[model samples]
Target: MLTDHHTHLAPDDDPLDEEALSIERIVAHVTAAMDRGLAAVAVTEHIYRFRVAKPAWAHPYWETQTQWDIDAYWEALSEAKAIGFPLLVGIECDWLPTGQEVLVEALRGRPWDLILGSIHWVDEGAVDYDLYSAFDHIDSEALWRGYVDRYARAALSGQFDVMTHADLPKSFGPLPSPATLGWAYDAIADALAAGGVCLEVSTAGLRKAARELYPSRALLERCNQRGVPIVLSSDAHAPADIARDFELAVEAAVAAGYSEVQQLKGRDRRPVPIG
Candidate 1:
């Protein structure tokens, strides 16, 4: 079965509004995913985009972006799910060193199908966005190292079901040689296997300046060798983007020796044969 567990209802460039969480919009995404022959899809919006999740992060960028109500977001998704929509209710949770406790408290007791752990920000600067790029304040090598360390910690935190876009540090462009980061990949694979967290093989990177899939084929092979299960995602921010470039994602997974992908629901996962 083909499934996409990482998807965003709201665009990253825009602050989420009421229209973004409407039942109509949610169904549109699901329908698009189904049209692409996806057996399942999950609407895992960024937690920082919700007003209630603001206390979990101290970044100024989050302050300006967190304006929508999380309750309404959930209510809409639940309504869609209640009516038998073929979608999962999930959230893409960011891993912040100082806000770990607050983030944990914020996500407790919710009916989450999956929680995708991501390391978008390394300290106060964003890794992918140029407006608050971490490269502006830190050197490329330091940023890469910091991102790897944070990702390892996030995977071991045991708070998420899957880790998305493992190589986000290179989203904007190329970095130092992979030889310099080989140890980081090994460490990440080990942490993910130890934590029992599945690694997301996302096609979103194909759309980024990196022009390659997230986590690279080398990292995917490392994770596969460590027995870290995988999930496929497009990281879609719009209905039309659902399952975008999934052929390449599947090819990459097969090339990495992944014959199965995980399907998630109510925080539990089951393996499905990859096509």
Candidate 2:
């Protein structure tokens, strides 16, 4: 079955940023996914609602999106479902150092199909956007080690359903060195298994400079060894991008010895046969 588990939708004129999405554009994107032969897709819009960052006056745009109401999210979900398209409601929640209980309570008893836990901003408010851009100057090994450490912490916190992308920094630019990041893959895999979290093989990596998945082949091998389940997501921002490189991801999964992949149905995970 062909499915893309990560998609974002926004008005045509909206900026190419997370906060620019709208419900009207989301429905359009969902229709596009159905037309493009996607059996199912998750509408995982960005919901990084943390009170940590103090936006400067220069970045006034950041302040406009400080609050993302869950009630509004479900309303959009209801509207999308009325269109008779197979769409799932999910959010890419940020894993903050504090507010674990608040986050859990906010999501409690919600009809969400999936939850993606990601570490976008570190404690010191260092976003990966800056972290990846300064790769050459910084110690690449130490940076990657820090990323893995954060991933473990994100998983162990018991807040997210899937580890969104293990090697997310690679999305920004060329990876500094493989040895450091490669060594941490096993820890991430083990963490996923222990925390009952799945890994998302995002196709955005192929569109990156490296033209390979984020974690690469060696990391997939470690995931296989640890028996960690996986899910495939296109991380599509527009309609045409839905399921963009899913076939290649399926091939990669099979090569990694995973015969089945995961999906969500009413907050419960169900394995779908991958052929």
Candidate 3:
């Protein structure tokens, strides 16, 4: 059965909405996933959306997002699972160098099925958010190199189950030549393999300006060659987006020589064959 390993409870644009973490919304997301032929999905809300994660987020944009209670989010997901829904409680954690300790401490002892590591911020600027675009001032090469360096570090940190959107810098536009960045991809693959972390094949880029799947074919092949396992994700922020563009995601995986994908539960994982 196909499973979506990454998703979100809050609206990407309006994470502070009171109804974002409601049990009703959780149920709707699971229902939508089932309708899309998915056996299960993980509701991985962004870590910065919770007030407790504020210490790890220094960007002013993050200040506007630390409005929700993580306990309430966990309770809501637990309630949904208790009622027999096939959804996993998860969180999408951003990689912040200055606040790694605080972030790790805050996430301790939770029954998380999945934790998606992401690098949305390169230093202080955001790679995807138009309001604080890193691309505005930083040249493509510097921004991409900075992002990859952090991605490798995050993969080696042993803090995440899957690394989502491996090439997130392309979200706003094209990046430097992939050939020149082969060393970066190798570093990421090596780090993931050493840390026993799975790489996420996300279709979220298809919805962004990049208009492509994450971890370009070249990078995916490198990770596969390095024995880094992979998980499929849409990075969906709403019910209708669950498993969106999955056919394309699967095709990309198959092309990259992936015959299986990882399924997660309570931080443990098992491999499921890809069709």
Candidate 4:
């Protein structure tokens, strides 16, 4: 059996309000996933802590939404479970420098199966839509080093279930590798190891310019050596994106020397056999 480590679900309410994210659409998508033999999916909706100037790429439905109520979150998970769908409750959290309290309180008393911790913004004052733009003034080594350090903090902070993507900023920028930075990637890998953070083998990179999993092969090997676990995900933003590249990602993990991957059931992670 296969489980999608990350997915988004549209709620069914207020035809106009949820037209795009209606439950009908999400169920259709889930049905499609079942057809492909996927046993379950961890449903993660976006949770924001601050206001921002909307970007052109922002989804219209999400433009005015700022937070998700704990009640609403549980309701969605309950409904999915009632329907015999093994849905895990989770959130894609954006970490702010000062919002840890708010996140902790919001998560209090809630049984979250998986939490995808992501740094959607930098200290530069605005949320970076094109994450690669973060490396504009810095060399590749410094840029990647900074990003990885932040990831290490996020992991050690104990706020999330897994680190979403380790080196996503490169998807949007040009950088010098090995030329300007001597083995900076190794340092980043070491940070992840020290922090006890598990790396996500995201397939989304294949659809991006990088066209490879985050952390790359060498970094993954180092993570394996450090005994860090790995989980697979498509990070599916759209309904159809569920389980988009399981075969390729699993192959990549095996090549990186991981013999097993993790799956969540009722907030507990259990191992799944991998070849």
- Scored by lDDT, the top model is 1
Order the numbered candidates by TM-score, best leading: 1, 3, 2, 4
**Candidate 2: Cα lDDT at 128:** 47
Task: Give TM-scores for every candidate, taking all chains together and pairing residue i with residue i.
Answer: 0.97, 0.83, 0.96, 0.82
Model 1 regions more than 4 Å off: none
Deviation (Å) of 181 in candidate 1: 1.7
**Least lDDT summed over 10 consecutive residues: which range in candidate 3?**
9-18
Q: Lowest-lDDT window of 10 residues in candidate 1?
A: 171-180
Which residue pairs in candidate 1 have backbone atoms (N, alpha carbon, C) closer than 3 angstroms, thus clashing? none
Model 2 lDDT tens row, 1-275: 66677776642224433344456676677778888777778887666432322222123333544444556666767576667768888877766656556566666777788888887644343334553244545455655666677888998877777788777766554455656666777788888888888888888788866678856877887887888888888878778888887888889999999999987756677888986
Tens digits of per-residue lDDT, candidate 1, 48-92, equal 887877877667888877777888888889888899889899999
lDDT of 3 by residue, 1-275 (tens): 88899887756777545487676677788889999988899988888888898877667888878778888888888888888899898998988878878778878988788888989988888888888888888888888889888998998888999988888877785577766478677877888898899999998889987788988888899889888999889988887888999999889999999999989888888999986
Model 4 regions more than 4 Å off: 10-17, 49-70, 125-128, 136-142, 179-184
1 or 4: which has the higher TM-score? 1
Identify the runs in model 2 with alpha carbons over 4 angstroms from their true place. Answer: 11-24, 49-64, 125-138, 173-178
| lDDT for each candidate structure | 0.87, 0.70, 0.85, 0.66
User: In terms of TM-score, how similar is model 3 to the real structure?
Assistant: 0.96
Candidate 3 runs further than 4 Å off: none
Best by TM-score: 1
lDDT of 4 by residue, 3-117 (tens): 7877666532222233434567557767767876887877776665213212212433334554335455557566766778766778777555554666666667767778888
